[model samples]
Target chain A: MSFKKVVVFPAKLENLAAIDALIKSTAELAGLDARSIYAIRVATEEACSNIIRHAYQGIEDGTIECGCYSNMDSFTLVFRDSGHVFDLTGVPSPDLDSCLEDRKAGGLGVYFIKQLMDEVSFEHIPGTGNVLTLVKYLTPDSEKSST
Target chain B: MEYIVEKLKHCDLLSISGRIDSQSAPELSEALDKIMESGQHKIVLDMSEIEFISSAGLRILINAQKKCKQQLVAGELVLAAVPERVHEALDMAGFLPLFTIEDELTHAVGNI
Candidate 1:
């Protein structure tokens, strides 16, 4: 029902798996389902990978923090990174109607994150770094569904 | 991550096992490049053993698809026996429609 644990790790991509496992364990403890768990993992991976690639610009020395919270109905993950200040406002909404051949290669990461989670918001602290808050409701349907 | 290649009469099957994320994407991309260089454009990726995939992994797949299309291959890169978790990832990323997915390896191999 509240913030249980917060983990900080190097911005290196090697740490992504550890972060994924942490989120899975926390989501399981909060009684989320496989689909919900997988969604959270995808969303988290996109955000973290963005930090690893763009936020830190592939610098190995940067660090990222993942803070997880949950209640009976939902789970929230706050990803904070001290790599680069990312302005989420700059990202345009993806045009789903665009042809595959015409579509740009990048930009799908944030689109997928938006689709998987129930709520997503971005903040850039001028002095600190970028923070992305992602929330997914543990709906009754998700609880009842399997696989 | 482990990549095992099996040569077929008309195509080359690349079986990718383990997590293909930011850490392992480069390896997978390089493997795909090698396969393409060999002139075997028809590919059926046996993804049954892969436990997870990230956006980086998807980028590799997209690149491979583009390469195959550019080569004018008779068939595009296909995926066989994808696990539910991986399928969910593809679906969430809106990639399910982009791929020619099969539920069984036999079906994928036979179809192509």
Candidate 2:
């Protein structure tokens, strides 16, 4: 079996649902269960929202391209955006032990994306832009797991 | 996202339904703000219908929680009926321990 799909759309918060729906449909067709489908959708939303709000700084209207593919072992999602390159080093994971007054929700998006997917990677090109890839391994040793 | 505000005996209950993303997050903020302004310190967010929540939404929840905490003697915001997906999302974001969450609406309202 072979499966691959791609889409390009404007980078706007209004388009988030559409992006999620597109990926959710592809994930469903790939035979993911409800939990996996929801994880993909949420992770995709966090990534795209970051682009729209931070990468683009909610200022410049940009474009984002997304792609999805299903291999025998895992499901993969890709995001390509021409917005400003993200600086991962500058962001800190929120201190979960911090007092309520000290705790911040700033970096939760990246954190959630990392938690939901098995593997996540990012790259920045001088002339192009940032490319983010997220993958979720299908249940090991089996394409479907009832658990 | 869509919300319906009900006047429970002890608090202002807002049952929010739909995706609370960047676009719709402010609406929830506004609703909470208006409630706070009206001198209603206790708020119950019935999230049984919220299917998706992004970081943006979580930010609003944290801010609201902090603000309501100041009035803890008289006002607070609690969560009830959180769906499994939403629970997992919050847990993943390290937010499960941040708020007073209950399994049922009556329990949440009673706590506040």
Candidate 3:
């Protein structure tokens, strides 16, 4: 199947549902199984949520663009934002061994994106914007099971 | 996200549905705040109808549970009927062990 779709919208938390819905349909139509589709949708949602929270700082009026592309073997989702560039590399995954009383809870957004996707790349363009691409490899077991 | 709040046997039961992200996290927090302010500590979040969750949602749960623990009396937050998809997110976030989760609402309420 040949699938290349691009969606550009305001970078806001309210638009998260729309973004997630799009990712769900796109991944499902690409012949992915339920687990694969959920993973991709979650990663995409986390990326967009990061953009809306950190990049726009919940400003209510920034811009976010996403492209859903797929080939025979894998599916790729790219997110671009233009408010403030966020460096995901510097972000540390929350320590899981900490005590419940001492545990912190808000820093797991980016970590979810990294853990769920097979390949994740973040780039900061000199004069353009930030682009985060999350890839999901298609499996033969899921190819026969499409939801 | 939509929440259905009901005062059950031993705790305040909140049945949540729809997507819980940055936008809806505040709503959940607000609901919990109201319950907490009313001197109710024990709570159960039923995610049977919940389809999605993010860090924002998880933060609310953590905060709520933490505040409950700080109480001088009985205070607890449990989760019930969590879907597999929601479980995946919680597992990836390293939050599966943070709270008492049950396969059935009765068990969660009893456990709490």
- Top candidate when judged by TM-score against the true structure: 3
lDDT of 3 by residue, A78-125 (tens): 888887889775688888767779889767877777777778888999
Top-scoring candidate (lDDT): 2
**Under CAPRI classification, how is model 2 graded?**
medium
The Cα RMSD across the true interface for model 2 is 1.2
DockQ of 1: 0.60
- Lowest summed lDDT window (length 10), candidate 1 chain A: A138-147
lDDT (Cα, 0-100) at B76 in candidate 2 = 73
lDDT of 2 by residue, A10-107 (tens): 99989998998899899988878798888888889888988887778855669899999898778999898888888543456777667677888688
The DockQ score of candidate 2 comes to: 0.75
For model 1, residues A28-90, the per-residue Cα lDDT tens digits are 888877778877888888889888888888567998889999987779999998877775536
Q: What DockQ does each prediction reach against the true complex?
A: 0.60, 0.75, 0.69
Worst 10 residues of 2 chain B by lDDT: B68-77
C-alpha RMSD (angstroms) for model 1: 2.5
Each candidate's clash count: 0, 1, 0
lDDT of 2: 0.84
Candidate 2 lDDT, B1-103, residue by residue in tens: 9999898789999999999988789999999998888888789999999988888888898888888888847467898999998887777777777888899
For model 1, what is the error of residue B6's alpha carbon versus the real structure, in angstroms, after optimal superposition?
A: 0.5
Ranking by TM-score: 3, 2, 1
Q: What's the TM-score of chain B for every model shown?
A: 0.94, 0.93, 0.94
